[model samples]
Target chain A: MNAIEFHSLSKFYGKHRGIEGIDFSVSKGEVFGFIGPNGAGKSTAIRTLLGLLHPSSGSASILGHDVVKEGVQARLKVGYLPSEVDFYPEMTSRELLEYHAGLYGIEKGEKRIEELAQYFELALDRPIDDLSYGNKKKCAIIQAVLHEPEVLILDEPTGGLDPFMQNRFFELLESLNKKGVTVFFSSHILSEIQRMCDRAAVIREGKITAIEDISSLLSKQMKKVRLVLKKETKLSLPDGFQNHHSTGSKHNFDYVGPTEVLIRWLAEQDLVDVVLTEPDLESIFMNYYQR
Target chain B: MSMNRTLYFKELKRNRKNTLIWTSIVVAFTFLILSIYPSFSQMGDQMTELMSSLPEEYARALGMDEGTWSSIIGFYSTYYGIYITLLMGIFTASTGATIVGKEERDGTAEFLLTRPMTRSTIVTTKFLALGTLLAVVYSTQTFFAVLGMNVFGDDVLWRHFVTMHVHGFVLVSFFTAAAVLFSSFLSPKLNYMGPVVGMIFGSFFLDAIAKATEQVSWLGYISPYHYLQLQAESGSLEVNWGSCIVLMILSLIMLKAGHARYLKRDIVG
Candidate 1:
């Protein structure tokens, strides 16, 4: 069964486009990634799915319940972590979690909250405002997952976490996914999406460019190569190269072929300088648009 | 519709400090205002003669329209009433405006909207909490007023005093509702307090202008202050009933509009 389904969902802030024609479904237990640059409508689509924003058109359902018409029911089995976490500043983290647990009717979730807190190394006694950004994020994650929700929708869920905490968070998500929790992860971090998602939907400028399995997505991946030649030279074009340009012996292009082929070709060029880097999601989307 | 009890208490707890502060302000101000009644009464005819000699507009501005300063009821209505209404209006307006909008302003709307509760429930819980806080503050105002009147003046007219406070509550309810309505459309960058203060003080100014000028007298109908002042002046149960109806209708309309706007709002931070 599909854990989540969005059918041509669109949201506009007055004349400003948020997300348009957003359609996809996350199968039960699937780790679905929503990859886009900032202001590319990934958060908009997720917020609409959570019923935080009403869609201008179309609909979304979670666990077979309509998010708009039956948001309460849809959210009963869903856990959401926003891109930026903020809580009642005066309340202690423990108080906030207890309050959330009460809302979810998880009477026995105290043990789970404690477990999650200990796992995240979060100090539950401190007020939310007193905690650092990473600590606040830990509190958010605990509240989201304490109910053992069937679906977890996270928007940029790991921004402030240290490397150790981030790895621990990933491990926790992995275990939860193993237990049949569907995950909808939204982030602009290409590598994080690549590492964690089974399938990813690429949104750019309020529209979905592609929705494909992670393996297929990897195949379409493009690396940006920047080289500064000692002098301007008429170089033979490489088959994998596109968007090739040279300015005063400085040349750049997106290479889609094997890394070795690009390296081999570059070795034969005039000696100067070269830099290889993974292109951001926007640049990749631009490449996809060109194709 | 399931009402989340946890959310209700959390909202009440969130507003606890604010409620205490407003309550204290009203209580302390009541003591300060009513304490002067003894000195005010000692002057008696001299004070009345001096007050009546002032220009009619200036006297009206001081809330001394055909009311003497010697009697506790007259003094209470003339001076204490204005301060009480203004303070309560500000407190209630600020409370109502911030109750829902603060979550969005602080970027906690995302945290709140994701919970297993409907938007209607969220609105109802917060609105009810605001109502509760207002009730607590008004009760303190009434308590302090009664205590002050008994200690500083002759036998307090308990019935009239209670009725006055009930009328004051209605006036504050209108301001609170208007504030909440304004908050629904306001940007987070624009603090709700500014608009609340503007609306409360603007209406008071309009109420004063209506009192001073014959041409814009109809403007009095638009101000909640006028409705409240009518109740204070009449001191009739029938007038109080009519005022209650008007205030209730106005408050309900604003609340309904705010609830609808809030339910449909796109919470982005």
Candidate 2:
């Protein structure tokens, strides 16, 4: 069974479309990424799937339990970390986690809470109101994983963490995923997706535009080519090359298509120096948006 | 009655301070009104003359009559309906409105709704908490009022006091449900005190005006206060079981409607 499924699920806030025809499923134990820019229905889709918002049409399920009809069962196996952390300000981190554990009927969460608190370097005694954004986020992270849920649904999970803390969080996620935990990671940051996702679905304006494998997506985009020819010679570029420019012995352009064809073409040129750079995920994400 | 104990307790603790403060106010007012009854009782016919001198419409609107200064229950009933019920209603009804809505207002709905519990469970647990808090305030004030009556009045009139309290409890419960219903339809960010006070005070005055004016007596039918009489006409006061049951039924309906609304609500960030 899929860890999570949204079969033609749609949500509308009256006439305003929140998410439309959002069809996708995450495989068990796979790290699946849901990527989009802000207001692109990423959070809307996440919220709907988590049963926070009712689906206007169709349905969603987690671990084969219907999110709307069998929401308690569906949510039982999943842990959700929201993009924004807003805990009860009166309670300390310890109290909030203990309360969360109580709701889940966890009888022995105090030890787990202490261990996670120690790991994250978060002060468990301080009120949530007094904690910094990063500290609060750490607290959120602790709660999300405290139950050791089978599925982790994270929306922009790394937002307020410093680089070192982010690194630790990613390591924790990696360990959890290795334990056969499925992760549905939603974020606007391309680099985070590139690092954590095996495959990613790109959302645009409340619809899924494309779902691409990380390696295949990287390999399929155009590469930036810069070369220093032996002399400035007039050259007829091939079909896959565009935006060619030359000055003295230097030539710069972009290449898309078969790497072997480019290699063969480059072999024919008298080159003194050559440089080929793969575009970052950010550029590729923008490329998808522009397309 | 199906409830999450964790959430129920958390909610009660959350409103504990507010409940304490409001309960204190009601308890203090209960004592003050009971304590001054002796002075009024000492005035004898002078008090009766004073009550008689007031305009008929004004006396009717305040639920005050010549019988008001005669006994502890009558005098206590006057202020109990106007001030005590309003005060307690403001606290419970306003608390009722904010209990679930506060999570939404503070952007914590995402966290709360995402829990393993269903929305129905959350609503049920929250309402249970509101009921518990209401009981704390209502019973505490009633206890102090009973104590005050014993200390201040010779006859005590326990039966009349019971009748007044029963009616007062029903009135406050009705308003509490109304607040929950209103919150489901209105924005969570609203300062519920204005609308809550308006609803409670509005009902009181609507019933009062209807009593004061013959042409608009129909208006009293719309107010819950009219059905649930806080003060009696003569020294003998009877608990209106029919009105109490009907208002309680309506309260349940409003509460059920609010619960249904919350179940389908899009808990936005």
Candidate 3:
């Protein structure tokens, strides 16, 4: 079953447009990455899916429950990390988690809170205001996952974290997905999405232009193969190899053929160091957004 | 019910500093005003002679014609009722404005709204938190006011204090509801000043119209401050139970409307 489904969802604030006709679905246990620029309706779409915002002219559902009509019920199975996580500054991490846990009727929430604290390497007793940005992000992450929610929706979850912490967060998300929890997250960082997301939807200007598997997306777009010749020798490349430019001893080719064809062509060339560069998610993301 | 209680307590915990500061100021102000009452009463004879020379309309405007000053109720009605009501209204407006709107200002609304709770629950919980704060402040002030008044050789009856406090309590709730209603509809940046200005100006206009013409006296019924008049008649100062009930119902209705709008409104990123 799809964990989330948006159908022609549109939202506008007075005369300004927010999102228009956003439609997508994340299947259960799938890591679906939502990619877009800052104002490409990414947050708006997530908010609408979470039932935090109402669509102006369409519908959304989670687990087959209508978001607008049965929001509370649908939200029960979901855990969310907002892009900007803000909580009561006076409360300690423990107190904040306990308060949230109380809403969900979690028993012995202190134990869960302690476990989360230990896992995230956060001090439960410290006030939220005193924590650093990365610690605060960890606190939010712990709170989001403590309930063991079936569906986790995170927006820019790793934005403030360092590279080490980002890797840890990805591991945590992977473990959660392994436990049959569906993960739906949005991020502008294409490389992170390429690594973490099984499938993704690229949105540009409030519209989803493409939704496809990560591997397929990279393969479909052209990859760059740069060959540095041992001796400046010219070789004839295949027909589809556009932009074959060379300077000094290095030859750059915008290779748009199969990996096997490129490998065979490189093997037939003179002694040289060849670098095969698969199209990164960043360039593909830019392709959608810039258009 | 549990969710509402949890959220209420959370709001209280979150707003402890602001609440404590406001409550302290209110208590200190009450003490200051009550301490100076004796000095004012010493000049009552001169003031009364001056009032007698003035026109009846002027005396009525100054609330001097209701010349029953022997009792605590009479003194409170003539001296501090209007002033306290205005103070309470301002406090109530500030509290209500911060309740729901503070979430937006602090960027916590998106996080809170994503929780597994209905928007009505959130609204009601915040409203309850504001009510709790008002009850605590008003009760504390009434306790101190009555104690202060008792030191002046007047028999401070429990019934009078209860009635006066009840009147203040209702108005606080009314103002809070009005502010929350506005907060839900307006931008967070304008939350504090907008509702306060509205309450002050709205009450002023309503009071002016009500006092200007007898035909429009019914308009007073629309103002929460009008129903909060605790010293209308001596020995017959009955609480307006009907209006009180109506005000409570209106507050709930307003809260419901806010919840409905917030639940449907798209949160701007």
Candidate 4:
């Protein structure tokens, strides 16, 4: 079953356009990444899905419930961590988490609160205003996942984390996904999505340009192969090789066809080394936006 | 239901200090006004004696004929009523303005909105919090004002005190509703200014129309302070129960409209 579905969703503020004709779906238990630059309507789409904003046109549904008409019901199974997490300054992290747990009607909420606090290695006694940005984000993440929700919507979840903490967050998300939680996250960091998501949608200028399986998208548009010959040599390339650029020591070419032709061509030359690197999600995203 | 109760209590806990401070201020001012009633009564007699020596136009211009020294109700109606009403209106409106908009100012709306509760629930909970605070403040002030009046004067009846307080509550309700309505539409940084300016201008306009022409007497009907007349000679100074009901209904309707707008409008980041 699809966990979320958006059909031609559009939003506008006065005459300023937010997003238009956005459509996508995330399957249950799949990690879907939404890749976009800042102000590309990534947050707008997420807010619409969470029923925090009304779409000017089209519809959005989560777990078979319309976001507009059945907002409370749709939100019951969803956990969200906003990009900029804010909390009551006077409440301690533990108090805030308990407050959120109560909202969800979680039984024995203290147990879940303690477990999440320990998992994140966060000090629960510190007031929210006294905590660092990363700690506040930890509180947000803990609150989002503590209820054991069926779907997680995270916006730039690792924006402020150090590399070690980012890895820890990835592991935490992976553990939750293993338990059948569908994760839909937006991020500017392409490598995170490349490594974690099963599928990703690239959005540019308020529209989704592509939604494809991570492997398929990378393999189709991002294969870059470099051939280094033993001696200075001019080489003829295969049919699918286009946009070929060369330096003195190596030739860089992008291909959209089978790898065999490149291999056959390399066999004809005295190649000292040949290196192939698939374009990461970042490169693919930049390429589309630049165009 | 339990969640709503929890949220309500939390809001109260967060705002209790400010509510207590403002309530104390309003009550102290009410008591102070009551304490000065004797001085004003003495002045009224001295003014009457002095007016006996003056021309009729000067005495008439000062309203010496209509003014009386013995009646505490008259003292309130002519002197303290409008002053206290304006004070209460500003306080109530400012409190309401800060209720919802402060969440946005503190950057806490994002956290609150991401919870499992619906948008309407959040708005309604905040509205209840503001309502409770306004009621507590106005009630406390009314209690102290009546206590001071009864202890200082003989002719002040308990029924008059009750009527005055009922009118105060209705006026406060109108201001609270107006402030909340503005808070829902304006940014938090600018929200407080709207209510303050609205109350000041609204009172001024009502007062001007009341003094200008007999034909414009109906304009006072639009002002919340209009129904607070406590010195009608015919003993017809009962509470304007119809206007009170309308104000309460208007407050609820504004709250509903705020909830709907907040639920549908996008956050400004």
Candidate 5:
């Protein structure tokens, strides 16, 4: 059975559309990515499946159990890491994790909690109110994985983390995926999605626009190219380049074609230096929106 | 309809500080009110003359009479009807209104509702914690009042005290349940203290005004405080078992409705 499925699931906040006809599935042990810009219903879809929001129509299920009907059963094997962390400010991280362990009926979660805390370099004794946003997020991660859940639903899990922590977190996710845990990863960061997902579903304005293998998605990668030339000279541009503008001897433009072709074109030019940068996710999303 | 013991206890612990603060206030007020009864009891003919001088309607409206100052229980009953029950109702009702919604308001609902427990269990557990808090505050105040009466007053009518307290307890419980029901339809970010105080004070004054003026006596039926008497009348008091049972049933219905509403609520973060 698929690890997670949303069969025409929809949610509305009264008349405001949260998500419309969201239909998708994550196969068991698959690292499936849900990608969208902010307010594009990525969180809504995740929240609905986690039973935080009641669907306006249709249904969702986790591990073959209906999210709304058999919510407890569905949730038993699922661990969720929310986008925003808001723990009870009065309790220390240790107290909060113990409380979380208590809720999941994990009698021996102390060892797991300590292990994750050490891995993340998180302080266990400080009150949540006293912790930084990044520390709170670390606490959130530890709680999410402490139960050894079979299905991991992570919504923007890397927010408020340093590069080192983010790296560790991704590594941990990779290890969990290797352990046969199905992961439904949701984020607006395209790089994170590209790095972590095997396949990804792109959502725009509460609708699933595209679902593609990471290989094909990478082939459509958009790059920002900047060139500083040897003297000012006009050169004919290729078909896939747009927004080309020049100031003095430097030229900048966005490219959305094969890197080799762009390189072959760049090699033919009289150049001082050339820079190719991955455009921001917003740009990538705009490219998808155009598609 | 399952109650989680772990959540139940955690909820209680969460509200422990507020409970301790409010409990201390009520207990201290109980002792203070009872401690001053002696000074009034010694007024004798002066106090009677004062009661006679006051407007009769005003006296009845405030649940006061000449005999109210004659005994410890009767004296305690007047303040209990006005300030004490109002205080208890406000604390419990405000707590009931926020216990579940606070999670939603603070963005913790995403973490909580995602847990391996049904929404019913959350509602059931939180409300049970609310009830336990009400009992703790109520019983603590009652214990201190009893101790104060023994220390400060003579010929204390213990039976009347029990009847008054039972009535007050029922009134507070019903208000707490009603607040839970009311909160389900409103935003969690709302300042419920205003409405909670309004409800309790509104019920008290409505009953008071109805008793004061016969023309508006029908209005008393609309308030929960009317059915439950908190003051002794005709030098005697008894637990109104019929009213108690009806209010208890209504409280249960409100709770069930609130639970159903909460179960279907979109716990927005």
Candidate 6:
């Protein structure tokens, strides 16, 4: 059985759609990514599986247990890191972790907690209210992994982490995956998802637009090309290039063809300066939506 | 340890300050009000004359029964006891209203509900924790009220003292359960002061209106205060099993229905 499965799972907040007909599955030991922009229902899908939001129709399950019917059992081996990690501010990190450890029925989690804290450079002794956003995020990371759950579900988990901590967190997740832990990572950041996931699902307007292996998805990566013409010249675009918009002497468009072909074309054109950058997830996502 | 026990302790720790503050307010109020009993009792005939001069309906509405003013337990029950019940009702109602909504308001609902626990279990544990906190507050207030009367008023009836606390608990439980019921449906902003204050004071005024206007005397039956007042007039601490059972059953119904709604709620935060 899959580690996580959603069968036509949908949630509606009154008349407003939270997530509609969200269907996906993550196999055991796979780091599956969920990519969507804000209000695109990434958090809604994650929260439904976690039993924080009840589905308006259909169902979901984790570890072969129904999320709604046997929610406690479904969550028995799961760890969740919410997008907004707000904790009891008055309590020290140690106190809050101890409280969570008790909830997960973890006896003697201090050693594991301390190890994660050290990895993330978390100040575990300070009160959580006094911690910076980054420090609080580190604390969130530590608490989530201390129990070493069989499945990890993170919604925008790396938002407040520094580059170093983000790398360390990825390494930790990789190790955990190696130990057969399944992960469901949700974020609007496409590159992060590409960097971490084996497979990814792109959602928009509460609907799944695409689900593909990371390698194939990366091949479809769109590069935004901006060229400054040395002289006033009318340039004709190629068949594979799309979203070509020219302003004055500068031209910007998304290129999906081979880099060698683009480089050859650029060499032939009278170009003063040229810069090729990766288009953000929004533009890429918009292309998918239009398709 | 189980999730419910862990959550219960966490909730208790969170409510520790609130419990202390509310309990102190009720206890202090009880002490302050009962201290006036000494002066009133000493006036004797002058007090009776003073009472007769006041408008009868106005005085009764203020909980001053002319005949009961001379007796220590009677005066304490009519004056301080009624207000103690009101304060306890507010305390319990606020506690019930905020306990669940606050989690959602502060974005901690995701943290707590995502644990390996069912929504039912979470609600049950929180309800138990709130019940435990109110129990502590009520018991402390009772202890202080009894002690205050002994110190200040003198000649206090132990039965009335004990009965008043019992009655206060039942009345507060009804309001608290109602608040929990409301909290499940309303957002945090609406749940806090509005429903609780409205229900407690609304029912209170209804009871007062029923007493003042003969035609609406049936209105008293709709308010928990009327039942409390009825039992308070009976003059014995031997549990008024009728009202106690009714209030307990109604509270249980509210709690069960509330839990069902809470289980199905899609937490916005």
- Per-residue lDDT tens digits of candidate 3, residues A1-291? 689998999988777787889888889999999999889888988888887777888998888888889998888889999888788787888888988898887877888788778877889889999999888899899889988899999999897888887888889899999999998989998888988999999888788898999988888877887889888877787865877899878899777667788778778887568887878888767766766
Which candidate's lDDT is highest? 2
TM-score of the A chain in candidate 1?
A: 0.84
lDDT of 4 by residue, A94-131 (tens): 88888887778776888878877887789999999999
User: Which ranges of candidate 5 are over 4 A from the true structure?
Assistant: A220-285
* Candidate 4 accuracy as TM-score: 0.89
Top DockQ hit: 2
List the candidate numbers ranked by TM-score, top first. Answer: 2, 5, 6, 4, 1, 3
Better of 3 and 5 by lDDT: 5
In the order shown, what is each candidate's alpha-carbon RMSD?
Answer: 4.6, 1.5, 3.8, 3.4, 3.3, 3.7
Q: Write the per-residue lDDT of candidate 4 for residues B115-177, one digit (tens) a residue.
A: 667777887888888788877877777777778878767677567567767776776777778
The CAPRI quality class of candidate 1 comes to: medium
Show model 6 residue runs off by greater than 4 Å.
A220-239, A243-286, B1-3, B152-155, B230-240
lDDT, model 3, position A131: 91
List per-prediction Cα lDDT, in the order shown.
Answer: 0.83, 0.91, 0.77, 0.77, 0.90, 0.83
Q: TM-score of every model?
A: 0.87, 0.97, 0.86, 0.89, 0.91, 0.89
Place model 4 in a CAPRI quality band: medium
Which pairs in model 3 have colliding backbones? none
Instruction: Indicate which candidate wins on TM-score.
Output: 2
lDDT: which is higher, 2 or 6? 2
By DockQ, is 5 or 6 better?
A: 5
Evaluated on chain B only, what is the TM-score of candidate 6?
0.91
Computed on C-alphas against the true complex, the DockQ of each candidate is 0.66, 0.87, 0.69, 0.58, 0.76, 0.74
- Alpha-carbon interface RMSD for all candidates, in angstroms: 0.9, 0.8, 1.3, 1.7, 0.8, 0.9
